[model samples]
Target: MINLHWIILLPIIFGTVVKLLPLKTAKKLMVLFQAVLLVLVFVIFIEVRKNGTILENIGGWPDTISITLRADLLASAMALLTCLLFLAMLTFVQNKHYADHLFFFLFLSLESLIIGIFLSNDLFNIFVLIEAATLIITILIMYKKTNLSIYDGMMYFLINVVAMSFFLMGLGMLYKKIGVLDFYALETALSQVKDPDSMILPYAFMITAVSLKAALMPLFSWLPKAHGTPSAPSEVSAILSGLYVKTGVYLFIRLQLAFSPLINTSELFMVLGFITAIVGFVLAFAQTDIKLLLAYSTVSQIGLIMVGINMGSPQAYWGGLYHIMNHAVFKSTLFLTAGMIITEYKTRNLDEIKGVFNLMPAVGMATVISILGIVGAPLFNGSISKYLISEGSSGSWIEYGLIFINLGTIIVFIKYGQLLFGESGKKETANSDILEKAVVLGLSMLCFFGGIFGSELISILFEVNFPVEILSHGVKLLLFVGSLFLGLVIYYGLFKKKNYLAVLNAIELGFNEICLSITLFFAFMVIYLKITL
Candidate 1:
């Protein structure tokens, strides 16, 4: 029923209506509503698993005229990941210093838009929801009022809105050609077209726009700046890095599914993904600020996910999706732990900070587990995803590329380990100790145990046969040893020297801007050729 759509609207509507209420009460109510929404997402996840897909058409209109909400396997997986990330964020922010009501409102609004993005079966609807998300996130970025926050927020707004414009134009062109905006309709129309190349304009445009949103390669400049700026409330950063960026990835996947025949080059995605991964880690390794390091790490992780999808094998698709979920959980945990650390120490600089583990052992343990998960240590979620991704890669070159990315991930996390557990001389207190320990313990358990059971979880969730070869014991041991060795090499060779960081930073900044411009130019050229040729 259309009422299902109302579930998303509940928090937004209530938050707006209660704007004048006491901020504390409003915040509590919003959190309560989000909990209900989380439950609803689980219900939908179960129902979709049982029924194949769930579709809701607004106002009793048929699928063609009404907006449609549908949940496929991919959508359900994303939704579940989102809910979990939201739960972590809520927990992390329970006693934080931010404006509770505004924070909750923004959080719910972002979640609603994300859910809308996943649920919508129509291209136009996806565009609208993405726009909504952009606006809400922009406000969230600007909420801090710092120079960096405002500047980065503006950059994010400008770039994404520009991309959204391209999306709208592409949708308009498709609608004009096919007289419909639904995925099925557009697919049908494109399938019947004699010149598939003609559709490249829209495809390029849409992909470019979504890539910017996803922080893939060149369009990623705004990400590190924005994400690193506001102190991002830990859990919010987790969601931003964890699930928000995946919106673009999901859109790209949906596009590929609907228009695979029209797409000529999967190599572009593969190559770009590889570049992003390498560049992201290089920059992350250079960052003195811990938040920036994690932010750049996101860029690298996303690249790995994209490369998995670009491989175009069933194994890769499953792996990509699995990685998406895995990244969300562990990444959120990492960010939350980072937040707790920063809150206690009141700094983001890694060099100045000393042995925090001494102050907060629980958080220290959690941080270690999260770093292990990110670096693909054995029996963690990262290993599962990394194995699948590597297995899905076709040529030796791509496999080697994957290996390099893995090495970079290992190296960056080694630096993270140094900062998290190294030499902070801060003293631990009785009160801060308990809270920090609790949060760390919970997240660490998830990172370590969750990885061990990830295969079983994926099998049950997707109702598909997960390949045993990819998850074999030998492969796990190899990855563990290889990654550990790589970490040690980087730690002794590069991080200890501390000379490559500046070079890596400059390269990342330059590469991101260049890629963004080139992609946008390519899209524009395609559109021009379509019009004039």
Candidate 2:
């Protein structure tokens, strides 16, 4: 019988073998390895669908005592995403010099850790997986060995280490209070608690850690540095922006669900999510470097996802989950194509690059499709999820907030959309990498099909039916068109002539400031919980 543990174990075991093999041999072997791993993930996903949820206790110990691996619909979906992205990224970079044995080892090792995180039902086990993943990512960030890269890596490492300490402390407190680290067990115990106050401190601690991981509002300072660092490979950036950072959001969902009985702070997160969304777009519009633009955009989209998740309705909550998948596909494509553009043009500045459609049609087409998807164009994946979130938030200020956020997204992308048009002043079309182009095109197609069949996909993915009515869909389409027109005018009329956004981008938070922000965030959460509960 195929087991969940093998899904986590195969990568590590094979990665070791690949690491010791000759470079050429290892390169070919790793592809096959990823293919096999993808199959395993598919099998597990199928099993999860057949059964409600799969549960296993290591060494046959009782569920409350042993490490637990649980694969429900949510976990299975996320695990499938993990496998698919790792395979895409690995394949995307196969022909590059960077796809060496050690790199492959670290990549697959990170994959194993992330999948472990998705499957683990024990709180301590999840923490350990997160910590291990962090270490692997640090190495990957500084893989190129530059001063700037090293600085980015160390800052990422140090800040995350400090943040995860809080997670560990919270876990210690929870284990002490509940006598078990299993998620289900903890939930049962928490439901029996008479006072919500007792869990506040630990909740604050663990949530602070997760918020940082999720790049929520003030805790997101480390994200751009880690994701947009020029020294890192494009595939690394793609995975980081596309999937890795999402682990934080995923954890936030899991932890919040586990703590739902004792804590209810949806209002607080909703506010923060809105702010993060606004700030993310403003920064993205100001960026000259291509990667930083995408990085800040990730921050903005994550904030939007957070907003949807906390909208206090099933439609919006599941919409938020669906957006996670949408963002993963679109953002991954953007990053991958950006890498190709940067390589072809030898410039990361947006001003110097143009006529991508004329020079590289395949890549240009992919970029255009992804940009459309992200802007929530009427027939794109983003539109479907955004509409669902709006539907859930209908008849309130939250609805208006969603509109403004979408407008801001349009404005930011309008600036980026320039890359697809105009003349590059070059005569020859650049040779394309077939594999890379294929991957990019495939993901871009997903962005379109995901939107076209959004309702059906949501139903299939989550086993829930919340169909989009035609009248409502038409209204959203009108709203999207209005937003797009306004965004274009704002981008061309005001932003094109002025550099005000550049000033906004100049504001950078240092390490000390980030730590201070973390402290303030925790304090605010604690105080809010005390009053609200």
Candidate 3:
């Protein structure tokens, strides 16, 4: 098997080399380098499949104390996802005017850091990677350098830096108490510790940081701005939504697992997740700007993914993982195509942007499919993941909560679907770059393929023999159809004429308010664990 360090280092090396080259040469080399990285990630995935889990300590150091890289099913899969999304983004942006060497350099550097986050087993290393990635993403978010962009970027930077301080403090606390930061070692150590309650503060601190990163509830005030800022390029928005935010979810899973023996906050996260989902869609439903709508939609879906993962069932956990992959594909497609549409129409308002089929057939087609996938329409990837998650929570109130979330998802997308009709009012032809069109379409097709073969893919990906009975659950089908029409009724009746919910879109948290939210969230977690534990 290939060394895990190389997978992390090769991209940085390639990016540095590309930065020193001329623009045209740099673009070509960038693609070549990302392809190489993707191949290497695939190899790591294969090796993990064959060997169960691959762990290596840097510089031949011992596992307990050394900086270690661990390749298990989830890590390898996320690494693969990082590479695929990077490669697609690279291809999608190759022909753009702003596709410069510096942009390529930052893009590749961020890719490496994200993959590093996936592979690193050392808590401090993960912290450094996240902090580094946070800086790069802030730059990318404000890459256009407008005054507003600079302000938006700074807001993102300030909030995340504050969040990471908690992470650093928690790391210090763990290292002081346990003297090790490696994931498995910490898990083992915690298992042996007599008083689990003693670790609750550290757990609360670390989880607060991750929850903010995952854009849970009150901490999500920054997500829409960071993701939907006009200064950010479409590809940057795509990466932020499609892959970067997922790092938070990934770390949330890891941190929870490491502390599982000591505490189980599954119930807390589930409630938070459901609230986040509801709030996300309610805000998304009121958006006029297409990109902001998509951004808020991401918040909603992440919450749904959290709900699935914390449903206390193996089926739901795997389904959450699958939905992660599904969201990456469709959301990337939507963001990329939304960029194209905004470019063509010279506006971001959903009401103004119409006749997409006539204006850009390929992008329109991709958008429709992606919307279907996101809405959990039957025979789409979202449906499959929702099915698994729902099946896992059968006969429970959580199952009904899942239903309500899906209904909100459908309603938001139904509002989003308005872009596909009416007139674009422009004389431009649907002559977008063939490569960009192909990338979007490819992602859209994966959404379909994922649904059709979801069962097999889930089994193979997670090494579980879970078969999904789509036809067996006739009620689910009925529920899905019912939700779609009901969503339509709700969208038209409640939202179309005079959107009372539109005021929700204007609500923004000031930096001070956001800080208070983080503190409140931490206090709540600490108190909840105190009462529950």
Instruction: Give a tens-digit lDDT track for model 1, residues 43-62.
Output: 87777777787777888897
**Candidate 2, residues 38-133: lDDT per residue as tens digits?**
888788878877778999888999999888899999888998888888878877887998778788889899989988998999989989999999
Model 1 stretches astray by more than 4 angstroms: 1-3, 17-21, 433-440, 467-471, 506-533
Models 1 onward score TM values of 0.92, 0.98, 0.98
Per-residue CA lDDT of candidate 3, range 1-533, in tens? Answer: 68999999888888888777788888887888888889988988988888899998898888987889999999999999899999999999999998887888888889889999999998899999999998999998888889878888999999999999999999999888998999999899999989878898899899999999999987899999899998699999999999999999999999999999899999889888999999999899889999999999999999999998998998888889999999999999999999999988889988888899888999999999999899888888988888888888888999899989999989888888888888777778678999899999998998999888888887767788777664745778899899988988988887788777877866888889999999999999899989998
Each candidate structure's count of clashing pairs: 5, 0, 0
- How displaced is residue 176 in candidate 1, in Å? 1.3
* All candidates: CA RMSD (Å): 3.1, 1.1, 1.1
Give the RMSD in angstroms, all C-alphas superposed, for model 1: 3.1
Q: What's the lDDT for residue 165 in model 3?
A: 98
Candidate 2 local distance difference test against the native = 0.90
